[model samples]
Target: MTILLWILIAVCFIASFVGLVYPIIPSAPLLIVGFLIYGFGFGFTELTISFWVIQSVFIILLFTLDYLVSSYTVDRRGGSRAAKIATTVGLIAGPFIIPGVGLLIFPFVFAILTEKIISKKTWNESMSIGIGTVLGILSSALLKGIAMLLMIVVFILYIV
Candidate 1:
């Protein structure tokens, strides 16, 4: 049972990272679930109050990063709400459709097309938005990846 719980917790942590690419997965919640499993299955004895507080802050940061980074990037490039929406859709669909590169390509293409067709932006502006979307995706992933690493570190420090 102990090993099984640990495996489940590890899966949650991994899935949380995977969620960075596939926005449909609830990344923060998965992390919380992993912690909860530790608390319940093994014991919460080592998980001090500070641990929870720090994790809570990281959770908030994760959520904020997810929303602010991508939106800000697109908006800075004069992208419309439609472009933002399409970028999200592309993020979710990209990996499955075209594998690794699709992650970047789909969002870029989607953002540009949405700007051109739905927002009636010029080709130049549309291209700018596409570039912004890709940049946003890359930066957001970098930040979130760091945060996730710190989160896991905190968990490890608390337990061992």
Candidate 2:
């Protein structure tokens, strides 16, 4: 039973990493769920209070990075406030509205359109911001993936 539980935990960790690539999937919360499963399965003896607190902090940082990194990148690339806002809106709405591809594409499109129409930016400038938004999102996903790996390693250390 313990071995089976460990296998399940491994699956969850893999799924969380895949989620980082897919965008529509909720990777960070899934990682937290994985930790919770470990705690429950193993009677929580190894997952100390300090461990839980540290995991909680990582989870919070994971979610915040999704927003902060993208917005910061857009702003740094000369995106207007409206462009940033539109990118955020697209980030939230795209996955649900159009599914897999939308998650990757909508934010870029929205940022460009918002910059061009609302900010009166030329096409070249708007495109640059749009690219920045996409790059920022990708970078955040990469960082989150690394963090998830760290969390998994910590959990394994505690359990073993």
Candidate 3:
């Protein structure tokens, strides 16, 4: 039973990592769920209060990082507030509306359209902002993937 539980936890962790590429997967929440499964299965003997707190902090930090890094990247590239907001909305909406392809297409399209419509920017300028948004999204995804991996490692170390 214990071995099976651990294997299940490992599968969840792998899914969380894959979530980095697939926006709909809900990676951070998946990580917490895995931890909870471990806690319930193993009785949480090694998962002290401090350990829980630390893991919670990491979860919060990584979640915030996902948004902040992308927004910061857009801002650094001179994207307006509306562009950033649109990028975020696109990211949230993409996976639901069109699944895998939407996740990749919506952010860029939304950012460019937002800039052109809301900011009254020329096509070239709007395209530039959209490109920045795409880059930011890619960078944030990479960072989130790394952070998720670290969180998994920490969870395993504490539980073991």
Measured by TM-score, the strongest candidate is 1
Candidate 3: where is the Cα deviation over 4 Å? 96-101
Model 1, position 84, has a per-residue lDDT of 90
How large is the C-alpha RMSD of every model relative to the true structure? Answer: 1.4, 2.4, 2.1
For model 3, residues 15-124, the per-residue Cα lDDT tens digits are: 98778767768898888888888889988888889778887888888879887888787887678999988887898898778877676679899999998999999999
Name the runs in model 2 displaced over 4 angstroms.
1-4, 22-24, 92-101
What is the overall TM-score of model 2 with all chains considered together?
Answer: 0.83
Cα error of candidate 2 at position 141, Å: 0.7
State each model's CA lDDT, in order: 0.92, 0.83, 0.84
The TM-score between candidate 3 and the true structure equals: 0.86
The local lDDT score (0 to 100) that residue 135 gets in candidate 3 is 84
Q: After aligning candidate 1 to the native by TM-score, how far in Å is the CA of 61 from where it should be?
A: 0.2
Clashing pairs in 2: none
How far residue 5's Cα lies from its native spot in candidate 2, in Å, is 3.1
TM-scores, all models, native as reference: 0.93, 0.83, 0.86
